[model samples]
Target: MFLKQIVHFSKKSIRLSYQFQTMSTFTSRTNIVTGNNEWIFVDNDNFDYQQELARSAFADMLHDHERNIQYEKAIIKTLQNLSKSMKKIHILDIGTGTGLLSMMAARALNQINNTSCSSRITACEVFQPMAKIAKKCIEKNDLSDCIRVIDKRSTELDLENDLQGDRINVIIAEVFDTELIGEGALRTFSEACKHLTIDNENLHIIPARATIYIQLVESSVLQEFHTLKNISQQNQRINIPNDCRHLAGNTIFDLNLNELKDSIRPLTKPIPIFHFNFKHINEMNNFTEEKILENIQCNYDGRIDAFIMWWNLDMDEQGEIQLGTIPVWCYDDQEKIKNIQWREHWIHGIYYPQESKIVKAKDQVSLYCFHDEYSLYFDVGTSPFPPRSFIPAILSRSAMAAFNSDKRRNKYIKVLEKSFSNSSIKRCLYFGDGLLLPLLILEIYPNIELIILQSSNTHLNHCLEAILLNSTIKLNYQIISSLDKNEIDFQTIDMILSEPFFTKSILPWDNLHYYYLIQKYRSYFRSNIKIFPQKARIRCLALEFNNLHKIRSPVKQCCQFDLTPFDEQIMKASLNVDETIEPQSLFEYSSKKPTLSSIIDLIEIDFEKNFYDKIEKKNLEILFIENGICNGIAFWIDYELNENIWLTTGIENENDSWINYSKQGVHLLPKPIYVQSGMKLQISTGFDFKQGQFLFDIIY
Candidate 1:
């Protein structure tokens, strides 16, 4: 047995707690030991160590001052309501993450000290590390006697042993996930009502009730995450089947929807679909399935691409101190909305249908919301409503809209049109997965011989469908099975066109797939053969990100709590992985002027030349122009379409139309580096076409 001890300091004295751990009890050799607490897991790979840190919870919950203030007010009200009774109160704080709520409850008890009531809080946490930290935090707040930290999940707690056979009178829990019931709140509530709570009418739940609100809205901005739209090939639209247009996917979106209200167009009024009564035992114990059917009348004529959903919490019994997660535009009182502080802990949910719904003004549409034990699903109907059942619908939607993006489609049209219209280009060969360009090119130049080589069957099928749909146009074309250099007649072929992409892409440079193809066919090409992108270059620069780095690199401490364990986990998990750079509007999360030297070119490649053989590997050193914490590097590809026309996925001071259309790449550092002006930073960069990977190492 291995013994570890934890020492906690208070204003008056220091207290120590010890726990014994046996190696046999652990499923794995690796365990995080912090003070006297050991966090054991089956395998390190199965756990998100950063998520299990107390600092993460502190950073999220502390920054949400609005949530903190509301909870404080609600706690006061709860204490006031409990003061009316003369009985002693036993409170159970389920999922007492950092013991913040338990501390708040203990503080509220101070105000009602003369109520002739004595109160005690039993705070429960599943993670041993967090529970130990919570215990220390409780002691630091000088509330150790009032609140006892139990290192166990609420479900695992026994009434006879853990609670000393006494049932709880007041229950306070913050077990809700992005989706209100995602963290098994329903099960927790059901079990608590059945076993842990007292059989009395005076039982009080801090949050009396919760209601979910939803509205149908149309937004091109929101659609960027769902389906890819085809509106670039001479104003052509991709036709989707009507049967595939109903509820497609349900996902919890945790962003500030209030900021996106300007881009959103509401099609229907907001409606309350689901309600959960936490205070009523019978209400919770008997609850199984929740279903809602309503005749929703459309107020606007538009395509309903998605549903915007949020929730409201009734904090007290009277519902005077209510907490809401509605977007700013949803509120009628604009002044009040502006005055009310926003919260990050709770955000809105966005759901996209399988197919977009087209509705006109005053159309009576049937809206249905159904839920089982853990999740919610929504649907729509007309005059004839469908019978509801417990059967689960496939509520999953694809987030990849690469094939559907209008901007991408437009770029392809411009490139293909340039290739087809040039009289010098008689014979052309294309190598790309995007089928739209080839079909569009064939429509324009019917006499030119076009050879296409696609490896993906899905891309080929899509092309076949487009060819069938556009049967009116005929073309001279041949699609070879492979991109074999021997099959192509280089002497006659005047041009080569490609979108430069592959299925296995995580970073922006993965599109170097185009360079690899060009290199493979370079020896067989004619001297005069033209390439669409005359040149391609990789640009890199240092950036001082605001909070964006936190997603990849864990902070050492948040709100004065130690997060070294989390930092270690993040560094281990993130090493050697080619991270996917999410398309972020950096204006929101990154500082533009980290240094005066902005976006310096790192490497350039000529598409027409065999540059892959003579690879450029450099150990470049750059100096900082200003003093700031350099968290990471941002890079993007600059493709020279022609001499004057260039396509770049980099930062630009452009309008929403341009920014939304472009994509930039990023790589977060292991930790932030505070550099002063003239500080030299060394970066080792290399790209191997054979391996199809870009290597970058930052050396300070």
Candidate 2:
């Protein structure tokens, strides 16, 4: 005996229309109210009040049973106008979303059948969570004989052979999309129509056509939203979350969707990212696109929630528009929901454009909207026009380090900028990385360019793949398990050393030659290297080895320095701590001591804030690229004489503790390399130390 009211109105046009919601009797406590006017409402009074407000059956969605009943009456009126020669009708309801549209269609068929409605109905749903609830509502209505609910999608329609019949004459699909591609409508309905429909014999509720319209919008809220605080502390995007970790508490003063990304079920969900209606549009017959040109309006004020639209079918005017609904449940723990002063249950995003002057409604706009994501973006076109402009976007932060120095970039910037003016190079290769100088170079200077990232770790392989897919920047990287960019097999290095390469010709790692020079002097290394300096010399001499520290001794002490003749007792060190603890268990606890370098590392963190302020103000463009799996990353940074640029990398295997603890870390250390190709090498650190004088273009 419950009644509800529903209103049917256009979300885009804001036009008032006659859509009513009338609820039919059901055994369940909640009743869905669909209006002949345009609103869809549902009542869940039986559910706990708090539950409805929190995550609940009704989810605080607005509805009325009486309104739903009236809407059903209007739907019946529309169905009656469709055909004249049928006694009974079979219907296939898609998305059965809330079970309201299907229910309306069922009630209308019953009116035409006289006395009562007894036509078969099949509801196809894909989400297990949604399908379960819908099945209960269908069974509670006592329409089980006529309406059968299946927990599946239209793509899997073959399993619903029982729902198909020769006399079946109606397919009521309410799955249209504003931009036919955003919602799951096209994928679901197209497949269903191909298999389940009876050609042009029966009436399709909304068979074809979706003309998407769009224009630029500016909002201040969007700018502020993009400035989210960094949590993990890594200066890279791969460190981003794969799940909804948190939500904004108040109105976002700013917004930015360009960098906001997430993995989800599909686009059918209409992820509301920024709000803007169509200012201009061009349409194709069915599911077409048209661009309304206008200036890009960005905000210094309010935020943008997401682009919004509602797509409806022309199959029957009796059917109402299936408006887009924001499923706020996508966030973790409902962390995304927020409340305003006037509305308690209504959840709204910040994309409402405040000023209309941002983009004119009549101007032709560019269609290459989401251009920065490495897509094949095409600029807006004129009638019978070939698309204008094509290039890729999405630059890596690593690639721009070169241009970070305004003072240093005077010459490089001019070279890159001038090169882009020719427009002859359809594709160019970027070699370096770090601050994404290459990407900015491509953007500032118009040219088709590709960037190759070289990495020694597999950690960024997948992220790099996603970056290639989403950004305008292309990737040429490798995913290898270890260092050795030249594909130098360790076995080969071992083989070469074993036969002709000579035992003394070990590939220099960590400048071990310096260690050899230090060991020969014997005076400095004898003590720490052996503790008993004389014994250390004897061991080194007897072993005929330039380096005794690398060799495991019968002793318990092995330090960074070699023991010379000047020291006391020889401290035989053991690399295997577990093995050493057996002989000296008591000493092991106090002896988990710091090495020389570790002792030097205890200096309090240098809060050298703004140390690079001068360098950061530069307009330089640096390209950093890492060849993934195949080689190392080509990351770079603006060169500074006073500040040292440290290069660090993390591999996928860092997730393991033993591998991590065993010293598998950044391949390139904080060594000073040359700054510019034309500049000479200045003595930075290693001239007197080791690693030899770094010889390069600025050759001494």
User: Over the full model, what C-alpha lDDT does candidate 1 score relative to the true structure?
Assistant: 0.64
The alpha-carbon deviation from the true structure for residue 156 of candidate 2, after best TM-score superposition, in angstroms, is: 3.5
lDDT tens digits by residue: candidate 1, 353-380: 5457899999877776766565666667
Q: Give the lDDT of residue 120 in candidate 1.
A: 83
Query: Which pairs of residues clash in candidate 1, taking residues 3 or more apart in a chain or in different chains?
Result: 228-404, 229-404, 245-355, 248-354
Cα shift from native, residue 517, model 2 (Å): 37
User: lDDT tens digits, residues 181-297, model 2?
Assistant: 444554454456566655544544433333332323343223232222222133232222321111222221111121122211111223222222111112223433234334333
Overall lDDT per candidate, in order of appearance:
0.64, 0.29
